[model samples]
Target: MKVTRYTKADAEQWDAFVRASKNGTFLLQRAYMDYHSDRFADHSLIFHDDKGHPVALLPANERDGVLQSHGGLTYGGIICDESMTTPRMLEVFDVLLEHLRTNGLNRLLYKTIPYIYHLNPAEEDRYALFRADARLYRRDVLSVICQDRRLPFQKRRARKVSQAQKLGLVIEASEDLEAFWAILEANLAAVHGVRPVHSVEEMRLLNSRFPDQIRLHVCKENGGIVAGVVVFNATRVAHVQYISSSERGREIGALDLLFATLIERDYADQAYFDFGISNEQEGKVMNVGLIEQKEGFGARAVTHDYYELSVV
Candidate 1:
């Protein structure tokens, strides 16, 4: 395999390859990855077979002599199509390391795409990372509900959903996201002292770029927004990218109702419904309260991994 650095000219080829990859999602597309190009020093890569057909692509960035498999996104790694096999992946990793070494980057931080996101088995990179002796640096557990085999919500959550239903909280898919972003921003600021990674404008731009892939579902009370979740749709997954509710919304269990509805009816067709991660401190600390809420809705643990490699 021959390796090449990604450039703006390769956008079309990169996105087409990502779309066909077994493990890649729209998030790895150049349109989505480059949205925050100003923040990250893009050093993403492409791997081609001897005939010059792209076999794998890595959505990555470099800074301070290190390369991250994209710091802007939730998770990423080597994106490969059906043509990729274990033996070929071993060579891919070898070429990948040499490419990194030649570029004077000595270390690589790789974030693996969770299995639920994969359209097919695509863990060859995980094996390659092990062969390269990559260090397992971080592991975050996503609370996910396997829709077809989903369990009923806990009694408390069920009661809340019932109560919220009586409150007449109307759920609708919205094209405009600013109203929901305001609620999300306020809730995050008050509860976590942080802001959402994507601004309303940025999110709107992305939604416009991938309208069918990204969606905002909001719960409204008497024509006012109370709660909402931004969902990123993948091959067989419906992942909650951002979730938030107003104080009054929380009081009435608006989120419980929202998720119950989404899991039970709205997104029931999706193979898995992810509630995002409940860990902090680089996946070292588990937020019991946070995860318990997801578990109450029949969500179980699915770990997302991060690994480090010494290329030199």
Candidate 2:
């Protein structure tokens, strides 16, 4: 087998391969890579068999000599066929590491495909790659939906939801990417004391690139957008990718009403709503609390694995 890098022209084949595989992530697609390639210098790599058919793919981004699974990507890496286990995965990783190292990259990080254990043979193959990369470790990605019977009825959850309704917040679908991003940035800083993962330009790029696949919703009161969410529609689920609100947003229950409205109107057909990840060690009681909140609305909890590797 031979390893080769991919070009923009290779997108269709890349996405086709990911869809054909059990453990494929949307981040591996060309559209995502191109949208965020500015953040990385080396964005694509593929493993091809003797007949030249691609067997494994590693979609990556490089920054300051460090290679990442993907920064703009929610998840990605050495996605391969189900039959290829440890030896095959090790071979591919061996090549990939060499390429990155030769290119002067120092570290590698990856968030493996979500729910790999629950997937089919193709998806299970990701575990093989994980096994080959000795430095990799698992981290928790918390999720909740309205269906989970085990979800607790936290007091804060009730208060927040009720407060949002009392504020008379109105939820509406919108295409105003700039406005949404501004709300996200402000919300993150005020609530979490941090910035969002994506910049306004990047958010706009993603929205413009996959307009149909993404939905932007804003919760308004008195002609102001108090909170907003960016939802991504995959094959079977709707992922709540980004959500943020101002100080007034929290007091007014803008978040609660916004999510409730989303669940009722836009994503009623989908089986689940993924609220994204939260760091478990940061005393993330709020994150856990959020899982419960979504559960009250008929969601359940699911965990995804996070992995890291050193190029040796």
Compared with the true structure, all predictions reach lDDT values of 0.92, 0.69
Q: Whole-model lDDT, candidate 1?
A: 0.92
lDDT of 2 by residue, 1-312 (tens): 778778877878888988776566455567766775555686568888779999888777667767677666766656776656666776776777777778777677665666522235544435545565645466555565542232434466666777777766678988777877877776678767988777778777777877877778998888788888988876556788888777788777788778877776677676566776655552233465655555665555566655666665
Q: Considering only N, C-alpha and C atoms within 3 Å, which residue pairs clash in candidate 1?
A: none
Best by TM-score: 1
Per-model TM-score on C-alpha atoms: 0.98, 0.78
- Summarize candidate 1's per-residue lDDT along 1-312 as a digit string, tens digits: 799999999999999998888999889998899889999999999999999999999999998989999999998899999989999999999999998888899999999999998888999999999999999999999999998899988999999999999987898888759899888888889888999999999999999999998999988899988889999987789999999899888898889888888888889999999999999998999999999999999999999999999875
Off by over 4 Å in 1: none
Cα error of candidate 1 at position 259, Å: 0.6
Count of backbone collisions in candidate 1: 0
